[model samples]
Target: MVPDTGKTLCADTIRPVNLPEPVAVREDAAGRPLMVALGRRLPVAAIEDCWRVDDEWWRARALSRMYYDVILGSGRRVTVFKDLIDGKWYHQSY
Candidate 1:
């Protein structure tokens, strides 16, 4: 016994979440993030952690990226990654 609702659920109604977005980043000689642009330039205070992921080699579009968890000068923490394949930077959050 449920009340009638005028909404229908289908594939069209589904949406993805937490998708990564492109970002501008400046790196040091060692390829460490020195600054990131999130509307404005934010200097990286420290790198909390770093890792690399290289997977799906069998697939046509393989994934290879270097991820960095950094703390900004303003005390905000963020996660950014550099696509090793395409050489582009993106920001993402868990």
Candidate 2:
């Protein structure tokens, strides 16, 4: 389950969370992702959160949104979600 810091920490007995297939980040005029934007630009705001849920695990890709939070950057604060199926990442909002 997701801890207080929003990190997924499955204990010994629990199965791993499923995630989505990885995706690439294209610069389409929008600001870069936090990972890429970290060194190059100083985020106007910066925050972190975590999640850990197990749903639809029987399906090829079955997971649920445990929780999310707003992280502000130099450009804007976005809500990020972790797809438990394939370990992919997504933005909740602009």
Candidate 3:
């Protein structure tokens, strides 16, 4: 169950969403990741929630995803995802 803003999640109904696949990447000489990860951490109150979803179970190339609804330091809402099979991270926004 999802908890609305200012509302609490029901303890007995707590479900463990599958955490996104973890990935490791070194910073480029151009410092892109520094501009991507640290640059995208959320603010204190704006992040509404995180969601997880998986798809393509009927196909060989399924994608398992976990999305984070993050309010960036700049007040922009962004979504980040992790790819389970290849262990990589990605991001998007609406």
Give the candidate number with the greatest TM-score. Answer: 1
Compared with the true structure, what per-residue lDDT tens digits does model 3 show for residues 31-82? Answer: 2232235453434234467667888889999868655565555766655655
Question: Against the correct fold, how does model 1 do in TM-score?
Answer: 0.90
Q: Model 1, 1-94: lDDT tens per residue? A: 9987978889998989889999999999999999999889999999999999999999999999999999999899999999999999999967
What are the per-residue Cα lDDT tens digits for candidate 2 across 1-94?
A: 6459766656865764543323332222433334423234433244455455677768876766533443444555545555544545554433
lDDT-based ranking: 1, 3, 2
Candidate closer to the true structure by TM-score (higher is better), 1 or 3: 1
**Candidate 2 positional error at 46, Å:** 3.3
**What are the models' TM-scores?**
0.90, 0.38, 0.49
lDDT of each: 0.96, 0.46, 0.54
Top lDDT model:
1
Backbone clash pairs in model 2 (N, Cα, C under 3 Å; residues 3+ apart or in different chains), count: 13
- Where is model 1 more than 4 Å wrong at Cα? 1-6
What local lDDT score does residue 74 receive in model 3, on the 0 to 100 scale? 72
